[model samples]
Target chain A: MAERVRVRSMMPPGHVRTPAYLRGKVGEIERSLGAFPNPEELAYRQKATARPLYRVRFTMAEVWGAEAENPDDTLDAEIFAHWLIPLDD
Target chain B: MPHDHHDHDDFHHDGMSPSGHPYRADNDTPLTYWQVMEIAIRELLIDKGIATASEIAVQIDTMDARSPADGASVVARAWTDPDFKGRLLQDASAAARELGFDIGALRLIAVENTADIHNVVVCTLCSCYPRNLLGLPPDWYKTRAYRSRVVKEPRRVLAEFGLTLPLSTRVRVHDSTADMRYIVLPARPAGTESLSEEQLAALVTRDSMIGTGLPKSPA
Candidate 1:
């Protein structure tokens, strides 16, 4: 089974790279990209700690519910590992 | 064609702006805050020996040289060569570099369009485009309407661009929210089997790579 993860819904007002729309959304990991420097800290001129990145795939139905353009359609986005909370299947 | 020489009497006129617009601003039309900031930062950088004036000019020239044609050639090769296409799908940045485009730190992903699925690229967070491969993004791509509406109502938005996909074809939208950029590898138009790679490249329009339109069909 594919690993499940949820985007952490933390909304701090600063140089956040995670999109607010994807926050709180549950998605499946499409692929795990190797570690990269943190953009949030780098945006603040702070030392950027390397973190793993993952591309997550979410269905339109999962994102928009009844308002989904097409329930069968999908969306993908790259998220930092820090923003993702592993979900047990 | 550069009707854009600035008056050195008013301010230093290195003509660093790639837009080719004259930086000749009078008190009546003072330079914008960003223009002044860019000038200040660029001057400071040059003064501090961190970068040379000509190096900046050459960098701008390099950026200006990139266009959809670079991506078109890649697509044309992919259409003609299955092995290259496989490599492109697996690792886009390397594949683009194979064609001599110095994408420089751009993490690119090429999504293919097939009979079962269609892919579109957007950046709901901002205009996170594959500028390294496709040049600067279209102006409308940065508009709030496009960034907001496309993710939620892609079919409707794509229809506005005159693309009406069948329901059987699942629409997949990639939002380049962070760390990565996307390009749509559009399906080659039919009746183009006899066309040369260069000719095929000519048919791959910029909009097709963005997924707003399809590649030009043979006339």
Candidate 2:
């Protein structure tokens, strides 16, 4: 079963794949996309540690609150496991 | 037109000097700052024996040879073959390879656009596109407005592209990253049953595959 997770709101001052808007927001894991070399470290040409990547799905309302044009809409982002915290139902 | 140098000098003598103006910017240099930097980096890399010029040329040729036709053919094949469509939705990279397109190290995912669901792709950090199949991404895909707004307000963004989906349809936006890329397998348009594989491929526009628009109806 896919797990629910929340994006960690870590404001590191370097290259990152997690968009700012998704930080600290709750989302559900849609799928496991296998493991990949950490891109955050790869951007610096350093040896990248492989990390599990997940496809996370967030509702439009969860991301944009009342400003969302459609509450039923959803967004999926490829986020590394290091940036996510498992959420309990 | 012969013997007009003196006449040209006289014409410019009213406000400007006969000699070139000292304040004039040098417009003869064809390379922009970024292009100059790119050349410098390429030369440095070559000098360091990291990559050869021939290798660079081959990479350029490979990128130049790719176009929307590759993606169109894949979509067309999927539309005609149910098993292939299953393979595509299950493993897009391998499915693309069946058509002679290797999507490199990055994983490729194909999201289906159906009557109840619509999918759109974006890359918020950078323009990580499926260039092997779709060629270069359009300029708009790289803009900040698109990278930021598409994930937040996809319905409005699609509407801006003249696609007003039914309110009942759910819009799902996919944000591609360095390790993963996405392409939309748009629903086959109505009245396209009579079209051949090649004709169906012709109907698959790059934007449609990107999920910003739908395929044109058969004429």
lDDT of 1 by residue, A38-84 (tens): 98888889999999999999998988999998998998988998898
The alpha-carbon lDDT assigned to residue B213 of candidate 2 equals 92
What local distance difference test score does each model get? 0.90, 0.89
Which digits, one per residue and each the tens of the lDDT, describe model 2 over residues A35-68? 9899889989999999999999999999999999
Interface C-alpha root-mean-square deviation, candidates in order? 0.8, 1.1
Which ranges in model 2 have alpha carbons more than 4 Å from their true place?
B1-33
DockQ per model, Cα:
0.79, 0.79
Compared with the true structure, what per-residue lDDT tens digits does model 1 show for residues B1-219?
345454543333555345556565557877899999999999999999999999999999888888999999999999999999999999999999998989988999999999888999999887899998888999999999988988899999999999999999999999997888999999999999899999999999999999888999977
Per-residue lDDT tens digits for candidate 2, residues B105-176, read: 647899999989999999988898999778899999999999888988888899999999888999999989
Question: Evaluated on chain B only, what is the TM-score of candidate 1?
Answer: 0.85
Worst 10 residues of 2 chain B by lDDT: B14-23
Worst 10 residues of 1 chain A by lDDT: A1-10
What's the C-alpha lDDT at position A43 in model 2? 88
